[model samples]
Target: DSLVKQIDAEIEKYFSGENPYRFTQESRELYKSIGGTPFLDGDYTVFGEVVEGLDVLDRIAGLPTDSHDRPMQNVVILSTKLKRK
Candidate 1:
C-alpha cells in the first residue's frame, strides 16, 4: 500500500502545474489574431506549425463535412517536400 501511494503521488505531480494555460510569447500573440485554445495549451504535444500552405489548410477546413466532422469528400495531398533555407 505504501509503494502504491508513492506511485500515485508521483503520477499526480507529473500532471500538476500552476498554470492551466501555457505557451511561448510568440504563441501567445498568435493566440489573439490567428487563434489558440488556452484550455488545451499544455495537454497536447506541439511539434511544428505550418509555416506555408496556410491557405490550403483554410480551404480544407472550409470543406463540407458530415455529422462527425469528417470531410464528405476526400482531400488528397499532392506532395510534401522540405525546402532547406
Candidate 2:
C-alpha cells in the first residue's frame, strides 16, 4: 500500500497547487479524452520480479502496442507458488 499512499500524496500536492482546477474530475475526463492508460513499471521488495516466464513477458511487450503502449490483449497469471529459499 506504500505505492498507493505515495500516489495519493502526489495527487494531493497537485490539488493544492495554484491551478486547483487541475485536480478536478474534468482532469481525469481530459485524460480519458486522450485515451491515457496508466501502469506501474519497476521492481518492488514486496512483489519481486518474475523468476520464470520472463520470456512470455518479453513476447507480450514485443507485441504491436497501442497508442499507450499497452498490449491489445490482457495477460492473465494462472497461478503462483512460493518456493523455499
Candidate 3:
C-alpha cells in the first residue's frame, strides 16, 4: 500500500498542472458506491475480472509481500477458464 500512497502523492503533485486529466463521473460514482484506488483510474489497465472466488482475492490481498511487493507465498495460476454470457 506504501507504493500506492507514493503514487498518489506523485499524482497529487501533477494534478496542480494545467490540463490534468480528472477522473470521470462514472469512475467517481463507482469509487463512492464501492471502494477502490481512485488514483489508479487512468494509470493501469485491467485485463480481466474475477467472476468468482472473491474470498481468494481477499486472502491474496492480505498476504505479506516482500520489498518488491511480491507475495511471500508463491501463488500460481495453474489455468484459467473464461466464460462469456
Q: Give the top-scoring candidate (TM-score).
A: 3
Candidates in order, TM-scores: namely 0.43, 0.40, 0.46
User: Residue 40 of model 2: what lDDT?
Assistant: 27
Per-residue lDDT of candidate 3, residues 8-85 (tens digit): 987787765644546789967988898876556668987788899889889988999997578998998788889886
Kindly report which residue stretches of model 2 are placed more than 4 angstroms away from their true locations once superposed: 1-46
lDDT score at residue 10, model 1, on the 0-100 scale? 68
lDDT comparison, 1 vs 2, better candidate: 1
Per-residue lDDT of model 2, residues 6-74, tens digit only: 999878876665443334688587767875433221332344546788888888778886765667887
Candidates by TM-score, descending order? 3, 1, 2
Task: Give the per-residue lDDT of model 1 (tens digit) for 1-85.
Answer: 9999999986686577545355789878888888766765667977666778999999999999997678999989998866655
Model 2 earns a TM-score of: 0.40
Worst 10 residues of 1 by lDDT: 13-22
Counting only residues 3 or more apart in sequence or on different chains, how many pairs clash (N, Cα, C under 3 Å) in candidate 2? 0
Local distance difference test, each candidate: 0.80, 0.66, 0.80
Clashes of each: 0, 0, 0
Q: Note each model's CA RMSD in angstroms.
A: 7.7, 12.6, 8.6
